[model samples]
Target: MSSSLLRRLSVGLAALTGLLGTSLIGIRAADAVTVPILVADVDSGKVIYAQAPTDPWYPASITKLMTTYVALDLVRQGKVSLDSMITISAAAAAEPPSKMGFKPGTQLTLDNALKIIMVKSANDIAYAIGENLGGSIDTFAAMMNETAVRIGMRDSHWYNPNGLPDPRQWTSARDMAVLARALIRDFPDSHDLFSISAIQFGRAVMPNHNGLLGRYPGTDGMKTGFICSGGFNVVATATRNGRRIVTIVMGQPSPRERDVKTADLFDYAFGQSAGWTSPTLEALPASALPAPPDMRPFVCGGKKPPAIEDGPGALSAPGSAAQLIGGSAANSPALALAAFSNPALRARSLPPRAPLQPIAVWIGRNPAEGQQILESQEAEQKAAAANTRAAKLEAAKAKRLAALEAAKQAREARAERAQAAREAAKEAAKTTAKPAPKLAAKAGRPLPHAASAYTAVETPSMPEAKPGKGLSKPAAKATAHKPAPAKAAPAKESTGKSAAKKPAAKKAAAEE
Candidate 1:
């Protein structure tokens, strides 16, 4: 490795952040990162240069290389034709971004789908091709594995048709290089599919993710993929001096780093003497890494989701390697003279890209048919949006109704508790109550009737008859029955016989 690369890789990320200052905002660390690099000729399977080429690593979007191979193979087998219409299934439409956004029922030709996936890397388009060709993703993945094994891939497994962050899906640098060779060798007619700089669908233009497509000289065709888990990866090819070289790079910290390193390796391989002897891609020793590294922390701080770029300007067609990408390859050095003993092979800067030539990619059989599909998709999207709105409104109304029902239940519960309390009080009264103490019958008198026993009226609190302070017991007893009737008798407080005597005495006194 050039010392410039070593210097960049060796310095701690915290220190690099201090160097670029604000310019380093989105820079990622490739430090201690396992990178798999391979450069081999297209005609001969011999590798000119390699490092950890057989290590297990997440393939990211390069899985599309296999996707393209399978689609082309099916076309070759006459099982399907490129012009056949593929109905976008619901599963296809539901995939995450980097997609064509075609509705579930919308239809497009397989030819158009392949083009879109090659340049746009549309996850949805790749998936639709899989479903239409192989019946489903599971079946399609089996097809991918079968094709991989047939093509001499030793350390690769695939799950999804679009390589969207699948832990189960992985491919090594050698495997990718081998797959790229198969793509170039088997389908010579479809070479343009990989070199499209940009694809124009309707008015929107999407550039290919492969950085070297237009910037690097004689660079023909390839693919690039990124997910936080897998970092940045590419399977690229460049033809110079009647020689075409396929390069595979995996697990670089950023797209710029991946591109620069690939370009550097290309420079090195192109300069190497013809006697360079190295193992064929298939014969390289396997890496001890049992599984692909989770690169989220090093590449994206382990937080950002897949398919997001550091900036909006990336993935442009034939544009300057702007900033770290298309602008000057300033971030990647010319490999300062001291970094390299061989003065000729230092990493070179990428020039501002030639103006982008946006290749027109449309849907359906022709531009007119593609227009109809686009209009239909728009209508369906509107309907889907309206349905989504209606669902949200219904959900809100249901939530309100549920709350009202809960309140009603709470009120009923309180009323039930109150009724239960009243019932309980009545039962307690019955349980604790004793029949009014039976009035003790005095001498021989019959006990008073229940109603008369506790009357509402009460007796006078003071005595009616007055006695001398010191009267003999016999005298008091004699006077108890025959009290003297004073001339001014106090009016009786009761209406029984006591008040009648008071009235009679008053009347007698008046006559007198």
Candidate 2:
């Protein structure tokens, strides 16, 4: 063969080799990732790509999508309004975080609550919404299951409104894609709720966890979920050139992986020729759906799968690899043909993420009414706080009064004791100050006398005539009587001496 012919043959062989290698890589990549994934056309209900689509897996917070559907259905039926209030119950408030953390009896309008549920993935709000719409969580779950069956979700079950961990709660990627399609079809008016990137309430701003909403070009709305047993999952939708696609990726190793995989799927689906078709979602066989896999061992048990990326010379997509090969060889004809023919094979530049404009929803109230209610709630809270403060102050005042009264009684008691002590001392001193009893002198010897029994008397003096009368016969007696006068005079002198001694004795007793 001529040299030119040989060159052409070599080029053809290289292209073939590159194509085969790329196909093998894709197959290997698909098998290496055990996670369930599905991409479908929203308009025709045709599935573009599928891997274990019917396999059972934990739903996690994605269960809120169903909860939202049921709620929106109730709204359609006129059973509830967007502005209707949903009173948070203890059960709802008690749900785990990724929650609103509102207390029981805290009220939020359904409109605003739905925004929180979509953006925050608030478990508590989801439960509260279920209760509000269905009268109880159990009833709401029943409603969810009923709707799921009606919508042709054969491999799904719901045990709670929020997608919290529950062994009985599970769903398949195919089912989620079905639900996503139905949501767009059945509730086009409320479809924008899923597209919200963030919501604001007062100072708190909750951003949606659906990374694809902004990172992936053409992405509009959907949901994301994660739990140890469920791994990371997402149901994403995008619109490009008037054509829309829905993709579900479950059991991803990380949020980044899920987002990249979803973006790649969108690029692949959108780039396909109009004539390309696959099995309709409804016509897909469901013979041997796999049992739900427990991802806890791989996700939470610290055993992680190896990272997989398309090799150089392989097709690339947005948010993933740029080119299969690097350096000068990247411009090879075979690679260029593959990348140009297949959008997924080419690198893409996504635009900067647009600022999120969340739809505003409030409890059974318009914006004005909601504002009024908020102000009223604030006023009530302030009033309750003021009342509590007043009560505390009253109690403190009463305590102080009681203490003062107790102190006054103690002082009175102490004063009474002191007064009693003073009286006792005075009585003791009076007894101590009294005089002692006196003794009498008799015949030059001291004698003790009983004062109560003794009395003193005076004797009349005998005259000197008694001595003259004793000189005659009778006078002789008279003279004898004169001697009696001498005796009487001595008695008088003794009486005078006794009177002087009495004063001296009394003075000595007083001194004692």
Candidate 3:
């Protein structure tokens, strides 16, 4: 009786287990998030582990990798030296935060700009780098795309230098690995540029955004990026013994998660046999997705997915450790997932970072020179302002003087006109006065012929003439009108005898 019942129970349990397993697989397939990951050997370019590596995704601030690349390339071309000064323009300054907040016209060497971007991930500085290097953001972006193609990045299109949000700008995990490898192989001297612990710009000290920089062993340098649309992203590099590896992680929900996930992958990658047969970054085929899937909904949506015991790539990479160890489908895409990810290890906090080694970056060629140039510029501006003010004052003063001069001239003219009028009026009063005959009558006497002489010389219809001092001839004429008791009367009385009688009278008077 016990055997029959036990067999029946066993059969029932087997059917139920198969059904549940199938349902779980379907749920995973439908609900799993798309996280593009890639791990590659720095020198060989052989991909040790990759997951959706070729699927397009937003690069976020990680776009600065291309920016730094373009700038360094220009330096390599000998077009611009590291010491060449670049300016923070208005457009660059206008960019939103994660910035240096330097004012427009602030000047700094390209070297400083590169350092600030790597450590601070400053959007403004990155934009300035693009503008300065490429003559504009668009041209720099063109350079980025060109270089992407040249570097064998098959799935990337860059529209901006700083990986700010733009639908047109996207890169695949495989492409990012290709870029990272290019940056390393192309410019070995710039190794410190990516892994700087912190940058001291004036008084402010900005730490690098890459959490793994100091927390993880053998971590050297690289980059990290994020936007709501593109979750926390990173292109990281680490060197152990003599080998370096590049790991690209995209679409993590938070900084903690990104760091944890990346650390997990690094562990899994380092554990795998380095010589195992694997696809190269270029060998990984591209995803057929037409567009980059937007991560904002899942990342920034009001409700985050509930935390589970396993982290990213946990479910997808099942039992592949045993398979990979035996070299079954080793070249095929499989999870680099650790054989078992203990909850303690996955959730463990990273160790405290080492003391920051901050590099001093300054404006212009040197701090002193930059200060001097700024001072000189400021002085020149002040002088110009003073000159402008002086010019305005001079113009106003000239205008006031001109008005006064005009007023003075007008007053002088008026005075002259008034004096002339007064003179004319006095003359007119004399001319229009009562005739001289009335003056004689008023004097109780008559001046013989005076009225006729005065009337003959002056007329009411004529403008009066001044009593000029040099009018002696006209005065004599006036006096000539005085009657001499009739000279002709005396002549008639004495008759012809006057001449002889007058002579005799004069001789007799002389004798007496």
Candidate 4:
């Protein structure tokens, strides 16, 4: 063979190799862009289609469904009532955009809060609810986790009540399917909160983030979520012919992709019948799921054209399936009504959402009757406490009065005893003051007795008195004579001594 022929063949083979390499690169790029998707029967919990359904992915605002679920549970348990007002703290008000921008101290009833959250996907409102019902965000998160476990959401963990971009806030499509089913089954009364197309707050009317509500046929209710890391996610529900279905699409490249994909999943599920044999959501294996992919760079900083733009008022008619089911050029009610005129779309479009008669909420206004109820409770407590204190004081006063009465009786008894002792002492003193009777003479000197002295005086008076003298006069005279004789005897003794002294004086003189 000629060398030139060999060179020509080599060049052709090189061109073929280059083309094959380019085609393989394109195929790899397409395959690498997989996302989590799942569709299930709302009533039976059976999976209709699954694509990496157990792979972990950031839940984004879809976490609010769990937040809503926990809130509804608390409401059912009477821990929080629909009319209960939740105050907005600074932390809750400070959350990033896609929020209500309510100032700290804003107050909203549980019912109003849920409506705003569902319609606006307001981050601040979600935070406020978690803080209010859980008493703190952390506690609310615990409740979310407990409820998730109870409902068999095995591959989900919650870091915040609002599905903010936390590295740890992850969930799987299968787990979300479990949650969506649980929300419908457990709290049927709250089902209306999710289907509301728009809510009016003061002068502002905020439409729901779930685009399917007004556009997709049979789209009844559910929620949507997004963060940079988890491009855009949606957990949507639709009903047809009395059969309900749930579809979950996570980590889509754009909101349009998420919505379109969800619509496709719903279409596929509704078209099936009883002969399908896919496993139920619970029967699917959930082990060894992949870690959530970080789409932050692609979502936030990419220069490439978006696969689908989800700008406001940019709702062009989607693919044939969407057109067949009443796809509209824009997400307006008028467009939705116009699109519904097609016979093919009429049976699929959800009935017009009921006008929202939202419970009143405010940023700084008084909480109305809720505050009054709280104040009344406090006042009653204070009054009860005061009554208890007064009762205690009255009891103490009664006890003191009894003590004083007993003391008074003791003093009176002591006084009586002292008086009796004094009387006895006086009697003893009188007895002792009486002179002892003179004992009969037992010694040489006779004791002077009143009777002996009377007898002696009487005998002396008898000798001198006449026989006929009266005894009374004789006794008086005798008493006077006894004293006179005693005095005369002393005088006579002195006179005799003087006589003897004179004789002795004369004899002494002769002797000298």
Q: Pick by TM-score: which candidate is best? A: 1
Quote the lDDT for 477 in model 1.
38
lDDT of 3 by residue, 363-401 (tens): 778988867766786798899999999999999999999
- Per-residue alpha-carbon lDDT of model 1 for 397-479, expressed as tens digits? 99999999999999999999999999999999999998786433444343334523222222222234367544245543344
- Per-candidate TM-scores read 0.62, 0.60, 0.61, 0.56
For candidate 2, write residues 105-140 as lDDT tens digits.
878888788888888888889889998899988999
lDDT of 3 at 300: 53
The alpha-carbon lDDT assigned to residue 111 of candidate 4 equals 83
Better TM-score candidate (3, 4):
3
Q: Report lDDT (CA) for all predictions.
A: 0.70, 0.68, 0.70, 0.67
* lDDT, residue 100, model 3: 75
TM-score of 4: 0.56
Candidate 2: Cα lDDT at 140 = 91
Task: In candidate 3, list every pair of residues with a backbone clash.
Answer: none
Which window of 10 residues has the lowest lDDT sum in candidate 2? Answer: 309-318
Number of the candidate with higher TM-score, 1 or 4: 1
